[model samples]
Target chain A: MNLSRTARALLWAALAGGLGVVYVPLLIVLLNSVNADRTFGWPPPGFTMRWWAAAWESGGVRDALVTSLQAAVGATAIALLLGTMAAFAVQRYSFFGRESVSLLIVLPIALPGIVTGIALNNAFRTVLEPFGVSLGLFTVIVGHATFCVVTVFNNVLARLRRLGASIEEASADLGADTFTTFRLVTFPMMRSALLAGGLLAFALSFDEIIVTTFTAGAGVRTLPIWIFENLFRPNQAPVVNVVAAALIILSVVPIYVAQRISGVEATTH
Target chain B: MFWFMPDQEAAVRLIGLRKSFGPVEAVSGIDLEIADGEFFAMLGPSGSGKTTVLRMIAGFESPTAGMVELGGVDVTRLAPFERDVNTVFQDYALFPHMSVLDNVEYGLRVKKVPRSERRERALAALGSVRLDGFERRRPSQLSGGQRQRVALARALVNRPRVLLLDEPLGALDLKLREEMQVELKSIQREVGITFLFVTHDQEEALTMSDRVAVFDQGRIEQVGTPAEVYERPATPFVASFVGTSNLISGDAAHAVLGKGGTYSVRPEKLRLSDLDAAVGADEHSATGTVAEVVYAGPATRFVVDLDVGGRLVALQQNLQVSSMEVTELRGSRVRLVWNRRHEFAIAS
Candidate 1:
């Protein structure tokens, strides 16, 4: 209940140190984005927008941005539809093998990302390619949808669980059909969650590297893939850092918006 | 449909409807018929399976056995929306993201009612519940009682034939619950929809329902008007459950005039006075000393210790105690007196 100045100062220092651990890199990227100097240091000698222009000028970066955008949007939309239905089925009804079904849907998020990527690659190579199935944007979307389903499934399912069945019953009692009840009581209630989930799915797809690496075909590079490739073969790729910074900013804004929109007080359960 | 009647009475009928979750029988072979425009209440303690029956009628939970009929049409296999019934949950369950108008108008929107018409009807229904000005407010902004009203408004806005209320007032405070009881009755009457009310509160059931069904261990122990269920309870469960009554153990054969239900006497109906002192000590009326007397403002409750039997409780209204000097403190052996007609013979 009582604390001396030194004790309070120690508490403040601990908090600032913790925050600095994460903040330092963010500050580095921001500072380096404008640094005329070649090093990633706390204090910059000079500032310039040259790296930003350098990143923008690269055709590889631009094309990959477009590819990632197109893939993420498609995957997230599909995930929203399928995941929402899956969430509904699991939450509202009972049937055989429900436990297994739940475990399968949760597997994507629960398992390591690399494992999911490897498994998907194996499935596609061994199963689909034998049937002449292509490995390109279609394969990429499928891969992204697999992981994105977890996000969509979680958000929508959580909202559904919290919402009572009475509203849906009220809709039914009002003479609405199944599809109508879905559109009205269930859909409207889940709108915020769905929108937030879809945005999150998009964010996940945009940055996903391991799964995309396994699934992507010839000339199907994403922005993150481009950054990874360029970062590995470093050459004044402070420009790559600029691109990473830009991606970070883009990802953070939407996620913050999603969190605000979802309105989950604490944990889903 | 007159004002969207979705017409007909005996609005919901359940025939041998039973439902179970795994090994637990939630509702066991219930046969109930709720008339249109009647407020029927299912009163019971927790886990009594009253809510399970409501869910079956709402189509949220399907019965494992038997049929459900709405307006003489079999809806046992129909989905919740397929049946013309609305339910107000104990939690209100209003769409959190939507505004009050949107929450109420959801049922209408789902039916593909035109936007303008839906808006008009939703506003009108909100007005019926005296919440016309709260269209733009979210459910979170409304007070507990107000949220309950919004839930009612939403359910009624679509004009479902039967409005299933599962403890609609359970979330409110004691004072608020009493107020909502009257409000719920009036609303049911105004809308002229069948109300299958469910609650664990006996006083609420007695005050509002046309008939009350007492549930115990997933079975309807008794079903009748409030007077019949309260004054002439058919089982020990019903007699002990509906209201407070004092039990006096006696020889089953000597306790009644003829073969009867478990013979029991109400505290007020017991005769004790100077007449008892003049009578033989072996008389059936046992000597009881006042153990504890509590002044409950409206009534004086006595915990009397009987010499021949055991402790008994008697509630004497303050109105009828002027001559008895109710202000006489505890530890006094006051004679308990009432008529035999007040005794309800419940099963042993």
Candidate 2:
């Protein structure tokens, strides 16, 4: 019993220690955002809402925030539509290059984001230059969506595999068309997974600095770029910290919602 | 709606149907015709091509050769949804996201039936399956039995001419399966619709089927009424598969072999009344000690070890008082015998 107790204690301590390493920095950033003193200080000398107000009032932040929201939401929607349809096609039927198609969908996310960003940047410069389209919201959305498709595809394909080919067949047997079966049976079963993947895509697109930096062009700036550009201004550090704190809080909502809807803590079927 | 109903001759019929997955023939050339109100059963062990036949008929799978016709109209190339059919799957296939009512109403919605009429129809269908109060409950929340009923209700709501059941009661426990068997039989009777039921369990096939087609190796071994199939199996495979029998092997005189090469007798058919030389004195007489006796409530199953052959199983109807020799204990010597009329002779 003593040995078991010691083992349990050790397990809990190890888990807490690992999580502490990841969360402590975030907690510090949040604390520093509210600190009355602009300079970094332990125990946060005093709490103040001055930086938060400054962040909200900042000229570039408001525009960047709006741009970032649009880009991320747009990327997530496109990813869910194209990715889910591709997943269904590749998973359900026996077609040529099925493995290649699956591998390609996952490859964008599997490779480093820097590689994806550079490739998209080059594509926009060479491929779309003749079309006279500049790398802006559309370019950044394309880059983020390239990687986000994997998440949506993975979520949907896993569900499709579990559901098997029965319900659709049952629907079809009852005189429902392919579209009807998808609308009635397949979509309902896949709602939670698709929502979770969409949230993941949005979260990825919202804070994507490496890819956004390469694709956003000279005139356009997302919130992350705005934060980076203003981080060095001695007067703006507190505002940047405040913005970071708010972004962190805003971003965690989807993750929490995904966890609630999926109940993913339980063992997967 | 009543005026729109098709005539009785519009039953499902498969003509020379054949299906192959790559190089493997899951279901080879086969033909079947189910009358509009017939409760036809396709009985086979796993991989005997029974479910494949039903799938082909339902349009989930297409026939590589031949045609599937409903109401005598060829639907061989049609998609599953276009076919006017429904299936109760082995796993129930209830939509986990939808409530019982939604599941039943889905077909109606697809058909563009008015919303009010759809609800009434769905409620009536659920009521038939004894799940009227379970409209709001999702399939995940329902018990196994209730989920099966929901699946049944969902299929029945479509008012399909041929209801294809692919081992629908396979997931239920033995008692529930038996109860569902009776329920399914009564439902078939009440609905008076053609049912193309598929199952491997002989008892299930016998209990619910007006006619059962015993399939083996992708071929129909026998097609007959349950009584006919049980009393007179067409082949050695059917004889052994349809019911339990103690096979007694011996070289009989041409007079006896005229019955068949291998002689088999059902346990209940074993006669213990007299030790006649003509019956037991034959070269095939089996004398042995009783090995085990199992009390099965209404019947006692005795394992009598044959000295001349292997262990012979014999069953006696259990009665309150001793009518005759019911059973003997282990190591007790006994001679088990059966008459020629009771013996089922097989070709091989």
Candidate 3:
């Protein structure tokens, strides 16, 4: 396991370079949110809270945040239900084309967002347009859900694979029926996996942009779509920085909560 | 003590039971009767179908052809939970999410027993397994042997009419396995429940079981008490599997014992001495050169290349001999002797 000094230094340098590339833009967004200069010059003339105050007061920002929350929550809820069921079906039973079914469940996410977005937009318009339905928050939620399912399915499938059926069989042999065994044994064991997957699915839906653009009809702007639209505008560009900064700060809570929950599951089990 | 009650029925019965997976027959045809309060073992190698029979009795498997009866009632098609039997699996299978007490109380909880009574009975069962203070600890926190006891306590708390143990001691080390064998037997006697134990370890089956059924390739080779199975094996598989046997067949059989067919002589039954050593006039003898000497502390086994054209392993109890004495016997000419009556003819 010995590593030469040069190799160790190279690994550390690569990690630091990767981190800088990832976080430098986020740092720039944070600085621009507080920059007193109107143009967001390379070096800030001074710092101020004016952009935060402006973002707080904007009606469009408030409405976009609410829409994003609604879509993310709807997508995550549906993903949790469908994803866990699919995970169980794949992990517990052998059926024809089980591998193909697993591949199909993951295909939506593996496909490029623009492809999925355009395909879904076309399907929704063609199928629902005849029935007098129009694309809105529901269509956006459906679009986000198609990709969010893969995250939840992967997490749950890993957990189910680790938790083999011997314990379940032991429960049945001890007089608990199938449903009772799932309630008392299976659910509690997989609770943390579900939480982690749900959080990831929610986060993926919350910040999605490309798919949201195609699926949302007029007047249905999610936070990411709103940010994209305002980023190029002269007056609202700083407020867009404020929104991105707020998103970066708020995302910490769920990611931290997920880490702690899975950490506890790892230790106690 | 006589534990069987007068009104008791046979705890488990298999009537021409057969099980197959597609083309592979796991248990071909098995008819067995286990008495109430009996400690029965199904002894076999892997793929020998002993565990399949136990699973069928526990309602975990459905026989392909025949019926399994528990307490004289047919239960072949019943689900595991509906049958009056529980299993202590080979892997211990304790729920890692639950504490030890909860694991033991799960069956009672499913049976709708009161919370307090469930706790009390679970604690009592844990106490019997010498794990009373571990009720609050998770199964992952316990040692391997401790987890095994928890599995045992969990099944025992159900108070099923029959307990199915599938190599419950297979995971333990040598010393712990021996200890658990004694503990398991005593616990079975104390509970007076019929125990259908499945194991491939011949010594474990011999030491713990009152009666054992030997299995070979989806068929029962023999069924008898441990002494009968070991000393008076009814089949070649039973003879070789239960203990080390020197299977002398064909020409070797005729040269050694003047028998025409196959016969088995236990290694410990044959006595070895120097080539010119005088043998008892009534003893069956074979002349051979000592090819190898294995020092096994309590007994020394000699591999003899017989002049009759096969090898014979003769084990001698190290009563007065030292390791050096046994080591010196290697490469020496030897005469292997055993009582003629000790040769049991094996019906091939």
Candidate 4:
């Protein structure tokens, strides 16, 4: 384990270099949010809270925030429902194409987001146009759920595989019916995994832009879309920095919560 | 025949039970009747279909053919919850998320027993298994033996008419396994419930159950008291499985016993002495050279190659023999002697 002083020094330098590459840009965004220079000139010349105040007062930012929340929540709900069912089916039983079903469920997350967005856009137009339904917030939610399902499915599937069928069988032997066993025994065991998966799915859907852009029709603008659209506007540049800085701060909550839940699960196991 | 009592109502009966998974027939055809309140053990090696039969009786697995009756009621088609029986699974299967008390009371809660009554009963069950103060602890906090006791308490709290235990002690060490064997037997006696215990350990089967069924390759080779199965194995499989037995057949049977059928003699039943040792009128003696010697702590085993054609093992107690003395006899000529009654003829 002993290392020469020079080697250790080199390792420390590499570590610092790696971390700086990742966090330096984020720090710049926070600095630019308060940079009074409006052009975001290097060194700023001065700092102020005007951009933060402008972001808070903008109605467009508020509307985009609400739209992002709705899509994330909607996609997370659908993911939890369909993903858990699929995980159970694939983990606990044997039927035709069981492996293929799991692969298909996880495929959307592995696929390029733009490809999924394009395929979903065409499919929605073809299937929904006949029904007089058009792409909007609902289509955005559906599109996000396709990839979000992978997170919930992987989490629940791992949990189910770790927990064999014996406990559920014991419950049934002790007089609990099928539904009672699931509600009392099986569901409680997987509750943490579901929560962790839901949190990750929500975080993923929240900041997604490419899929949202293709699936969302005119009049629908999620927060990421709003940020992208306002990034180029001359007047909204400082406000965009404020919102981006805010997003960088807020994104830590769900990721931290998911890590804590899964960490607790790991220790319990 | 000695264990079966026709007058007493059968607690659990399997009539021509059969089960198959795809191409593998787990349990081909099993018909057995266990008496009320009897501690019955289904003893076999792994993949011998003992667990499958227990599962079918517990209603966890439906039989491919035939009926499972509990106290004169047909329960073959019933679900596990509908059947009036509970099982202690092989892994103990205690809920890792629940406290010990919660796990024991789960059955009562599912059955809609009142809170106070269920709590009192669960505490009593835990006390019976000697796990009283460990109620609030999670299963993860307990040792293997403690977890095993929790599983037992959980099943016993239900007070089912018939309790099924599937290799409940297989996970524990030797000392703990032996201790639990005595505890389980005592618990079965105290509850006055019919226990259908499944195990692959022959000694555990012998020590705990009132009667043992020796299963081999999806069929029951023999069902009798421990003494009956050990003293008189019905088949060659039972002879070797239940305990060590030397099989003498064909020419060896004719040469040793002056008979022409298969015979089994326990190694411990044969006495090793001088090659020219005198044989009694009713004793059968075989002259052989000691091929190998195994010096166990309490006993020494001698593998003797018979002069006629085959080999037989003789187990001699180390009561008076030293290790060096026994080991030196490895190449010496010896005679294995046993009473004529010790040799039981097995049907081919």
Candidate 5:
């Protein structure tokens, strides 16, 4: 455990270096949002709130924000439902291919996003086209849910494994039937885990672009897709920086909420 | 006392109970009847099927083959909620998210009891366990012993026909465990409910229950009063498991007892003395070299390597002997003497 002064200094330097690498670009984006120089020239010659005002007044930005919220909320709801059910089935019971089921459920997240996007794109076109359902916001939500389910599944599965079946059995022995035991005992115990998972799922769906790009048809446009489109436009470049900076700030809310909920769970457990 | 009623029914009964998880049979075939108001203990080691039987009775597990009856009514196919029995799990299993009062009142609430009555009964149950003021605290906020009491109160509030306790005090420290053992027995007596307690601790079983069933290898080895099981074990497994006993069998039985079958002599029964100790006509004595000596505070145990082809453990109270004196007896020749009546022949 003993470390020389130089060694300790080196370790701190490494940590600082690593964090700087990850956040320096984000800080630059924030700085450029008010850089005033429309070209985003290094060490901005001046600062102004003109870009923020422009982003606020743009109807395209507002529409993209609403579309992103709808997709994230829809995807998170589906993830919470399907993921919790899958976690319970895999954790609580023994069946053939049970291990494989967990692996398969988690595979979507481990896969390359572009691969998932391409596969989902093809599958939706072939399967839904026959039913007169085309790729749009619904397909984007479905696509996002495919990977978002992994977060909810992992969180709920870990919670269930830690909680054990004894408390539920104790409830049943006390004369509560199956449904009552789940509602009264199991569900309450899983509430914080569900919230944490749902938050993470929402955050993931909010910023995902590759999957959204493949799934969203001409009429659908998520905030990430809008940012990607406007990032290259000569006139909308400063406005995109404003939107990106705003998103960076907004994204903190769900992550912070998830961290607090999981923190509470850790202390209580 | 309840047995004196002519129309009284047995509190719980199991007929040909068998449970198997895959290829491993946990409880082979068990048939037992516990009288009303009796504190019954199923005592065994870890893999001996006692808890499995208790689970079957509680309806947490359905037996692979057998009938479980409560008050002469067959409830073999009933769900745990439908059965009129509650279990205190070994881990206490108090609901972590609920306050102690809510945990205790859960059963009553599930049964649709009025809130005021449920609270009153839960408070009373908590009072019986001597944990009255702990109602508002969550289970995580309480100590192990307090959580145990909450679990007890939770089950007791239901006032089931029978209560199954599966090694409920196994998690407590020795002193706390002993204290809860007495408390549990007293509570059982006060409620006049049949208690089917499962335990791996023989001493706990002997001190708490009116009758104890010794289980071994998925079968009941013996069922008797504490005195009967301890003083007169029905099988070799019971003799050694219930307490320390020296087995004199085969050549040792013939050489020591002038007999051929197996016999068990309790370590405490054997009197240890000098090599030249005299034996009466009613006494059986064996000459041996003290192989080892264990000083256990109040009593010193001597492992003797008998000249008659076996080893025997003799427990002698350190009433007058010092630890140094007892420890010095190792490697010395000694004679183990016991009355012939102390040797009980075990039927294989």
Candidate 6:
């Protein structure tokens, strides 16, 4: 159990090295947002807020931000409802092919993003094309929701496993019927888990690109797609960096809140 | 619901109740009645179907056959919520997310009781369990014993006709369990509600119950008062299960007591005397060699190998003998004597 001083020092060094490697690119993106250099020259770059101003004023950026927010929120809402139901069904009841159903739910996140995107694109084209519907923001939300379900499912499933059926049984024994027990006891216990799961599902949908690329029509542009397309354009790359910086800042709030909520849950018991 | 009337009508009744899970029959045919306001204990070992019976009473399990009647009402098809009963589960099963007051008030909330009245009644229930100051604490914030009291308060706040307790004190330590047993009995007396307690501990059942039913292998072996069941057990299983009994049967029964078939003699009833001690007219005597001595705190037990071809356990109170003298009696030859009237016939 006792680690040598040299070994402890080496472990600390490795952890710091890992964190530095992960954050260095993010730091560069933040720095490049303010760089005055036209081509993002590394050393001689002066500081300016012109790109931030440009990003704030651009109609395309505003529209894409709205679209991404709508898709992420819609996907997260659907994921929370479906994932919690699926978790409860699989956890509380036993039936044929239950294991297969669990595996199928996790398949979207397990498979390569390109494969899931292509499959969803093909299925959507066949199913919705027959109804005279073209791919739009709705298709993007659907695509994001497919992978997002797994995050919510895993979070809620873990919570359900920790919260056993005994309390619910006790509630019933105390003369509260099924719906009453759920409202008074079950929902309150699971509120934190649901919030954590929904936040994770929202974050997953927000950063997704491959599935969005395949499912979105010409009229729809999510923030990730907008960033990708602007990354190669000569005049708009710094503005793209500004948008990425803003997205990074926006995504941290939910992730941090999820971590805190789950942390509180772990300590409460 | 007059407190002292002790309603003689059956508070709970089971008529030919049976339950089976696929192939395993957990509870076979059972017919029983629990009088109103009586503290009835179902005593059995693990897998003895005692808990299954309690669950059936609580409406957690519907009988595969027969019916359950509560106060002349057939509740065989009712859900747990529909039944006018509450269960103190083995683990207490308090809502971890709610405060102790909230848990106690849950039943009232379900009935749409007004919030202020719910709070006052819940506080009163908590006071009955001697947990008044713990209203704001969550279940997770309390110890095992506190949680148990909270569960008791929660069940009592509903004022159900019957309270089914599934080994409510099983989780506490020995000292705490004994204290809670006394407290539970007093609480039951104060509440005057029918208490159907289920436990595997024989001493707990005997100490707390007005009537005890001994269960074995999905059937009731015997049902009687604590003393009646212990003294005059209807079956050999009951005689051995309720407490330690020296069972002498076959030729040994004939040789020792001039009886054939089978009989049970309580260990405490057997007396050890000098090797050549003369037996009185009303007493039966058997010469035996001491095989082992077990020193319990309040008494000393001697396992004697009888000359009549059976091993018998005789318990002597430690009040008269010092520990050294009891130890010296180990492996000594002795005569075991007991009055003939003390022996009871046990069905094999």
Could you tell me which 10 consecutive residues in candidate 2 chain B have the lowest summed lDDT? B251-260
Taking chain B only, the TM-score of every model is: 0.89, 0.87, 0.96, 0.97, 0.97, 0.97
Which residue pairs in candidate 5 have backbone atoms (N, alpha carbon, C) closer than 3 angstroms, thus clashing?
A: none
Place model 1 in a CAPRI quality band.
acceptable
Kindly list the per-residue Cα lDDT of model 6 for residues A91-189, writing each as its tens digit. 999999999999999988989999989988999999998998889989998999888898889888998898888889898988889998899889988
What CAPRI-style quality would you assign to candidate 2? Answer: medium
Calculate DockQ per candidate and list them.
0.42, 0.60, 0.79, 0.85, 0.90, 0.76
Could you estimate the TM-score for every candidate?
0.83, 0.86, 0.94, 0.96, 0.96, 0.93
| Superposition error at A105 for model 2 (Å) | 2.6
TM-score: the better of candidates 1 and 2: 2
User: Model 4: clashing residue pairs?
Assistant: none
Query: Which residues of candidate 2, in runs, are more than 4 Å off?
Result: A1-16, A41-47, A96-100, A118-136, A264-269, B1-10, B245-263, B272-313, B316-336, B344-348
Q: Tens digits of per-residue lDDT for model 3 on A1-269?
A: 89999999999999999999999988998999999998898789998999999999999999999999999999999999999999999998899999999999999988999999899999999999899989999999999999889888998998898888888889899888889988998998888999998998888898999999999999899998899888788888889989999888767677788779878877776
Error of 2 at A189 (Å): 2.9
Tell me the tens digit of each residue's lDDT in model 2 across B37-69.
999999988999999999888887777898899
DockQ, structure candidate 1:
0.42
Model 4 / residue B107 / CA error / Å: 1.3
Native interface contact recovery, model 2: 0.87
Scored against the true structure, residue A162 in model 4 reaches a CA lDDT of 88
Which parts of model 5 have CA positions greater than 4 angstroms off? Answer: A1-4, A41-48, B1-7
Q: Model 4: per-residue lDDT, tens digit, B201-249?
A: 9999999999999999999999999999999999999999999879889
Candidate whose DockQ is highest: 5
Error of 6 at B35 (Å): 1.0
When summed lDDT is taken over every stretch of 10 residues in candidate 1 chain B, the lowest stretch is B252-261
Q: Tell how far residue A236 is off in model 6, in angstroms.
A: 2.0
lDDT tens digits, residue span B135-176, model 5: 999999999999888888899889999999999899999999
Question: What is candidate 1's CA lDDT for residue A7?
Answer: 100
